[model samples]
Target chain A: MCIEHKKEDIMKLVPLGDRVVIKQLVAEETTKSGIVLPGQAKEKPQQAEVIAVGPGGVIDGKEVTMQVKPGDKIIYSKYAGTEVKLEDEEYIIVKQGDILAVIE
Target chain B: MCIEHKKEDIMKLVPLGDRVVIKQLVAEETTKSGIVLPGQAKEKPQQAEVIAVGPGGVIDGKEVTMQVKPGDKIIYSKYAGTEVKLEDEEYIIVKQGDILAVIE
Candidate 1:
């Protein structure tokens, strides 16, 4: 089940079945010492904001419910999700289990 | 909190918070047509068996409980967990969200 949410002009996508759609937080382009890093030199950020949530359902006969919702900021494994493009924007679709923590 | 379980002679490790300790499943050493593949040619398996689990607790004011427990076979993100060694054996520690599906 996909859940859609609107954030400004961005078309938010909702994930299904213990899945979450995340918009990655942008990394700083400049170093603390003021040197600007090239795009290729920067690693993908693990931090993201939860844009959509899936309704947790049963898997392998076990009932699972989502622990996160839209608008929650989260930290996830670096290579967790499948990258997708929507509305000319990049997003990630990750299982709930791939999320490491919810950032306060 | 960490929970320990023993399987055969293996010293199992329990994870903390939403963490899970997993033993990765071995991949096939040969192809379906009978060609043997070298160890380095094989990709790390994504499927694993749960050996230990941590008590789900509050994170960022949210009460989170674990949806998985010991003995559940699961599929997770390929690069999801941190690799660790114990008793000369390799294991992985992954947060619950890294798990994709529990295999029946």
Candidate 2:
């Protein structure tokens, strides 16, 4: 639970082999009906900002090509990806296939 | 379920790219503790005999080379693959990656 790490530490993370590191966007504070949800009541957003994309290469005997890039806004599959915490921030690392679509 | 389908009908199954058709081995009737397991009490075994292997090629933008061949005994991941029943027989269709190991 250390919040004292430098931002440089977070930037040092490099995902390998078609895995992309992403930062989940904060959940909407108000519902469509304008009801403000409590902190724990909010659903985890499936939308994320791509932070890093792995290099395209062969993995598990299958050739993979990374299709997304850093700074892209994407929607990912629910319940997919592993969560990683760094420098007081959290990120989800997932494969390119986990990203369902990119938002305009 | 019809029990009159010819064996040729089952042999005619051709697995598509990276998929394999396998027949599950019957669960052991007796445990090492010398207790007989009722039909409903037996656990589904993970081992299966491969009936067909997919032709390896580019699939989903990845190059794949199949490793297992027909008649090979293999262990597959639990909860993986789809079950198909025909003529009083059951088979599982799974990706080659789901086959964890081949028994010599």
Candidate 3:
């Protein structure tokens, strides 16, 4: 038998322009340099797990699809993304290009 | 006689696509519901003083100018903007449309 699912069970669908939705990696996990960051550190790096991506960037009035996909672990610039709170859970949505590099 | 100015004094010109640069108001100020947010508040409302604005939004392939300008104190969606640290000072850059409403 197949089970039915609610919309909440699926990631809410949001169409973005050359953008993607990222489920932010918990701030406490990732480390930088040779030392681990304490909880109270003022400048914690923002890392995220990709959830959804837009079709592609619009270049010269043409729509392009993205090279990245969901489930990629990415290292975005600290200054990237707009912080959003969805039902008390924080998420960030940003352009695909804003992602500096992928964590291998 | 007049004195010439440097680029630093000119707000580092950045031409954005319907975006704007905002000098975030010192988080220490601004109150909500008769209560002021303390420095330690986990969730501080991000209010900003507009320093620069883009020409306007791009609808289709046409460019449009912004309705607002520099020095406008506005309230933006908390989730809006990409943060940039310039000379150790934090500023947020976002599309003019991200500004939800102007504060009275």
Candidate 4:
């Protein structure tokens, strides 16, 4: 999903705590073994666009401030989040800590 | 190692960021099939005593406060930490977030 994916659709799925909901910007991925990898191959996607961000608050006894906002392009660590399915759309819910960098 | 293992000796090692150094509290562990597991086995030990705690401060752009102090017996997630052998004494360094519960 990109910036034009409609904020209203993403707002339907609210994240809890310091979690952020993101949709992968996928590309046809190929593995080092010369095989086409599956969509969920883990290596397939690390880049995403933020769909929604949780309200920053105390999480696990630590003050967390959500640094990334919706529509921000970001890169997350491989295998960092839980894949969530909502209404036929797949989203990855990751803690703010799992986000590696913003793509600017 | 327990608190009786000498706090002075543990002080030699200092953890960085929100990491905590811990030593496993071991027992003769058996697998689901009833085979005794080795000391390094992941299922063998989950209980640990805090050997050292890092100073509370900003880590990874997040403010972290060290909650578990040295000598606090805690239960950590299995396979959660990096094992370090400092001067022949083995210790596991884990982020405080990986600590599950403290033993009262």
Recovered fraction of real interface contacts per model: 0.00, 0.06, 0.00, 0.00
Clashing pairs for model 2 are none
Candidate rank order under TM-score: 1, 2, 4, 3
Identify the CAPRI category of the predicted complex in candidate 3. incorrect
Off by over 4 Å in 3: A1-104, B1-13, B27-42, B57-63
TM-scores for all candidates: the values are 0.47, 0.45, 0.42, 0.43
Candidate ordering by lDDT (highest first): 4, 2, 1, 3
Give the least accurate 10-residue stretch of model 2 chain A, judged by summed lDDT. A7-16
lDDT of 3 by residue, A68-102 (tens): 57897765556668878554555788876566444
Q: What is the DockQ of each candidate?
A: 0.04, 0.04, 0.03, 0.02
Query: How well is each residue in B30-63 modelled by candidate 2, as lDDT tens digits?
Result: 7679987744355555668899999978877777
Model 1: colliding residue pairs? A96-B97, A97-B96, A97-B97, A97-B98, A98-B97, A98-B98
lDDT for residue B53 in candidate 3, whole number 0-100: 69
* DockQ of structure 3: 0.03
A31, model 4: CA deviation in Å?
Answer: 51
Across all candidates, the chain A TM-score values are: 0.75, 0.79, 0.66, 0.75
Model 3 Cα lDDT, one tens digit per residue, B1-104: 23444445533524344667787776664566666655535565677888766545453356567876788989888888777543344567776768887886
Where model 2 places Cα greater than 4 Å from the true spot, the runs are A1-104, B1-11, B30-40
DockQ value of candidate 2: 0.04
Query: Residue B62 in candidate 3 has what lDDT?
Result: 60
